[model samples]
Target: MDNFLQVLLDGVLNGLVYALVAAGLSLIWGVMDVINFAHGEFLMVGMYVSYWLGFILKIDPLFSWVAAGLFLFILGAVTYKIIIRNSLGKSGMAPLLATFGLSMVLKNFCMNRFTPNFRLLSGTILEGKTLSFGGAIISVPQLVTALFALVVLSLLYWMLKKTRLGWAIQATAMDKEAAELMGIKTENIFLLVFGIGGACVGITGGLMTSYLAVYPEVGGLFSLIAFVVVALGGFGSIPGALLAALLIGLVESFSGFYIAAVVKYVAVFAVYLAVILLRPRGLFGW
Candidate 1:
């Protein structure tokens, strides 16, 4: 029972991270109708940004997260304005192909610059701290990351529910043509949403770097998981994404413990398939 509880708690912690990543993916898809294949690359960019700031600039990893997120936000906005905007109406294969090309470019660029070697960011903040609750042991970094995720998720929820720009985003997502007819600048909204989405990915990347190794291919792995998350939660559904992320996180944690570690992802995939089979639109999809 103790082991089970520990695994469950760990799963929830990991799920929160996955939720953060999935939220960004869902936001971009919901608002812009463009699936960003480079979503993970944005994460990779964040990790690298935090890595440099923490290692070279001698900044705290937490502080570096803010810097990385802001930088990625700008990057995302620019990418949207320069590349995504051009492929707005041409959604069939052009955007997909273009983004795929962009992903390849990012991968190669990272490979050239950072290489495929794994990198770790070391700092006093994240070393040698653990919290024990009953039989469960939680690390300080994981706790901080989870708390950060909760705070950010709450703020995002509030923004979407209570703010004007949030309303614009929702309206645009619901009906782009109608939103434009109602004087909403759909293009600008897309840009903002893309930026915000990227910012989320950036933050996730920074947080992940504290716990996971940094590699050029890290983005691709996370991107694939994000895709599954979005699909499992329902495309363009924020709440759905959160819920799905939690589910996947828990499954991954428990499966890895009771089953084979290599099969954890397979378990997640199976869950996704089962959910899709049962509800084609997704659990919380409208």
Candidate 2:
């Protein structure tokens, strides 16, 4: 029971971080109907930016998170202008292939530049602190990760539902032609949504750098999980993503502990398959 509780708790925290990573993907898919296979590579770039900022400029990853976000936002926008713009409204597979190609370029660049070395950030304020409840140990970094995820998610939700820009985004999402007739500037909205997606993952990467290992492929792990969350929560649904992420996190934690570490991902994938078999549009596609 004690072990179960510990794993469950850890899963909840980790799930929040997963939701943050998935938020942008959901946003882009919801608005632009683009799968963005390269989204994971954007996260890789964010982690590297945070890592290098810490290594070279002596800025803590926490302090440089905004920088990482800003950098990725610009990159995402430019990517849309340069590569993604041409692929819009074509075949269903065009954006998918384009983003996949982008992912390859990014992964290769990072592999060559960083040599696939796993990097860790040291001396962050939340590095080694822990709280124990009975026999279960909760780490400070993860708790903060959860808190940060909650705050960021809340802010994003508010912006999407309450702000002028948010309304425009929604209008565009409902019907692009109608939105354009209403002067919504859907292309800009698409650009902004894509940028926002990159920024969210970038911020998530910074939070992860507090304790997680950094490498070119690290983003792929999170990206896969994010896709699962998006599917589970319903594509482009923020609240759904959060709920699904927590569910996944708990499942991963429990399976990893009770079953085997090597097969924990199998458990996660099993959940995805179950959802697909039972609910193709996702558990909460509505």
Candidate 3:
């Protein structure tokens, strides 16, 4: 029971981070119908940013998340302007292929610059810290990351539900032509949405730096899981993404503990396949 409790806690913590990453993917997919194959690469880039800041400037990742977010926002906007915008209204494969190419470029660039060696940030404020609750021993970094995810998810939900900007985003997503006719400037909204998506993953990357190692190829696994989360939760649904992430987290933890660590991912995908087979639209997809 104690071991179960510990695994539960770990699953929830990991789920929260996965939700944060998936939320961005959901947003981009919901709004632009773009898969953003480069989403994981964006996360990888954000991790590097935090690592360098901590390595050279002695700034903690907690303090550098905002900077990482801002940088990725710029990168996203530039990507839209330079590449994605041109592909709009073309074949659906265009954007997908574009992002796939982007992912390759980013992976190769990071490999060339940082090499394939894994790098872990050290001496952060949360390093070597743990908190005990009943039978569960929790890492402080994981706790903090979970809390951060909650706050960001709340804010994102609120923004989408209450703010004018969010309304504009929704309008654009629903009908781009109609939105443009209504003076929504869907192009600008698309740009902003992409930026916001990038920022979400960027912030997540920074938060995760305290516990996870950084490597050029690290984003692939995350990106794959995020795609699964988005699809499972239903595209364009934040709440769906959250629930799906938590489900994946729990499955991963339990399967890894009881079954086998190697087959944990297989279990996750099996669940996904089952759910997808039943509901082609996903849990919350319209």
Best of the candidates, TM-score = 3
| TM values, all candidates | 0.96, 0.96, 0.98
Q: What are the lDDT figures for the candidates, one per model?
A: 0.85, 0.89, 0.92
Please provide, for model 1 over 1-286, each residue's C-alpha lDDT reduced to its tens digit, 9 standing for 90 to 100: 8898899999998888888887888888877778898898899999899887877887766778898889889988998888887876775877777778788888899999988899887764786579888888988787787778777777777788899999999999999999999999988898899899989888888877776778888887778888888988888777788888889999999999999889999999999999999999888877
44-95 per-residue lDDT for model 2 (tens digits): 8998998898888878876888898999899889888887899987888998
Q: Which stretches of candidate 2 lie over 4 Å from their true place?
A: none
- C-alpha lDDT of residue 223 in model 1: 84
- RMSD (CA, angstroms), candidate 2: 1.3
Show pairs that collide, candidate 3: none
lDDT of 1 at 145: 78
Winner on TM-score (2 vs 3): 3
Please count the clashing residue pairs in each candidate, in the order shown: 0, 0, 0
Worst 10 residues of 2 by lDDT: 55-64
Model 1 TM-score, all chains together:
0.96
